[model samples]
Target: MIRNKKEYKQYLKRDRLALEIYNDGIINKLKNLFFPNPIWTFQKRMRKLEYYTNCKNYGLYKLYIYYLKYRYRKISIKLNFSIPINVFGPGLSIVHYGTIVINFTSRVGANCRMHACVNIGASGGEVQGPQLGDNVYIAPGAKIYGNISIPNNTAIGANAVVNKSFSEENTIIAGIPAKVIGKVDIKKIIKYV
Candidate 1:
């Protein structure tokens, strides 16, 4: 959801911080160019694609956008990810490269750190998906579906099946049908938010 150059830059900075890559020097750039992390490369291309897609006067850069799309798709397939563009806000940290499927209609807030084997989608044929709030941490093997809304600073435990909406924030939800298990300090989980 990058609307302008400033917001795009801000998103990139937050993304880098979320990925824990602080340095942006020439040496670092050259190193990344030669030996890039697959996830980082994919995220970088994803951000570029999002920015250009939201830009208005990019007549000369359509080919570049297509190229970015191709690369994004290729890497996503390789990494076993089914995420769509603009679904995640700034500061998105994919902790591991594994099977992570998210519905295109789902909206995740900023500072979300998700692990592997996470599925966020609709229950059946529904088009709408879960809307997660900011500073949420989704653990590994979490299955969140339906048209639910998760509050801010919430933590979903591993292997939890969330189908209903929780009314509170800053809580941990984990169970077969996902209930508030305990309170959570989001700052301890997500460091870069």
Candidate 2:
């Protein structure tokens, strides 16, 4: 359903759905609120759905949701060239969509928001991948390759290419090979609408 308001509210009526959404929001917000970086509002929105869903165990939830996400992502990648996906909880949200190829070893923190045409994979068969922190925001058309660690609350600008690890907070990164454009405020982003 791509996570519209009506769908979220309807889904939240269930006990488990409601609980899960809250936890998701809490986890995502932690990085946004405390971490020294900016996060994506879309991710926060996904978390609210988790809270509304009332998910209990993260492990089981991750497995179930990830499987579904992987399926959806694969299909969307093949057809639409656009992934209007709503990824909740954990695990599967990291599922690659379109030409977005995520390496098997890539570890993503809670509440990351990714868009279509993103490629997060290994560099030169290194086998190692990115270790992304909570509430990271990657705009469309970004490519993050190699064994990199993107710290909490960082925002990668649209069409940016990231090849190295970055830990500084509130940075707005952009360009081919992604340079720090500036810093961003996660709270301000979360407060968005």
Candidate 3:
């Protein structure tokens, strides 16, 4: 489906407003007090905007990102690496991004998603992270760092870890150590718009 120009403008406007609210209230205040610089502010604002943009329409967001990537090649390159936005799927809901890293060795399945401040990196400094399966959704501020195998139809709750393997499907993984909490249907995981 083609999202119209008007719709795109509305999305961008709403997005920027929401970001400004967050930044003015939380981010900028902390950033100014701790690390006072324009570069950090630029990166922070870009990440937050990128998060909202990702949760919007893919084609529209892609064009916007392409423009920014062209405008600021150096910043865009580093942003792409520092924050792993679409590590799982296109319809991923990203908001308020921060030090998020999705490992290159790991492979995430279709219909899978994640939110802001998520780190899917290697564990033990040797064994890599889990290979995520289809319909697996993770929440905000979550960290999944370890050698594991996540099956299809699983939901890793906010700030949880799956440091083990699940050969079966339809499960809920949560907590610091990370374990199966409950079962969930795969169909419930995919719903765009």
Model 3 sits at a Cα RMSD from the real structure of 9.4
Model 1 ranges with Cα > 4 A deviation: 24-34
In model 3, the runs with Cα more than 4 Å from the true position are 1-96
What is the C-alpha local distance difference test score of each model? 0.91, 0.57, 0.58
Error of 2 at 106 (Å): 0.5
**Candidate 3 colliding pairs:** none
Candidate 2 structure quality by residue, lDDT tens digits, 1-193:
2235554454333312212333357766684466512112223333453443344326666666665555544544443333233323232232223455456577765455666678777799698877787667777788988988888778888889899888798788889878888989854543321
Write the candidate numbers in order of decreasing lDDT.
1, 3, 2
lDDT of 3 by residue, 68-147 (tens): 55544455454443543333432233444344567756767654456666788788775566688766777876777677
**Index of the highest-lDDT prediction:** 1
RMSD of 1: 1.8
Off by over 4 Å in 2: 1-99, 190-193
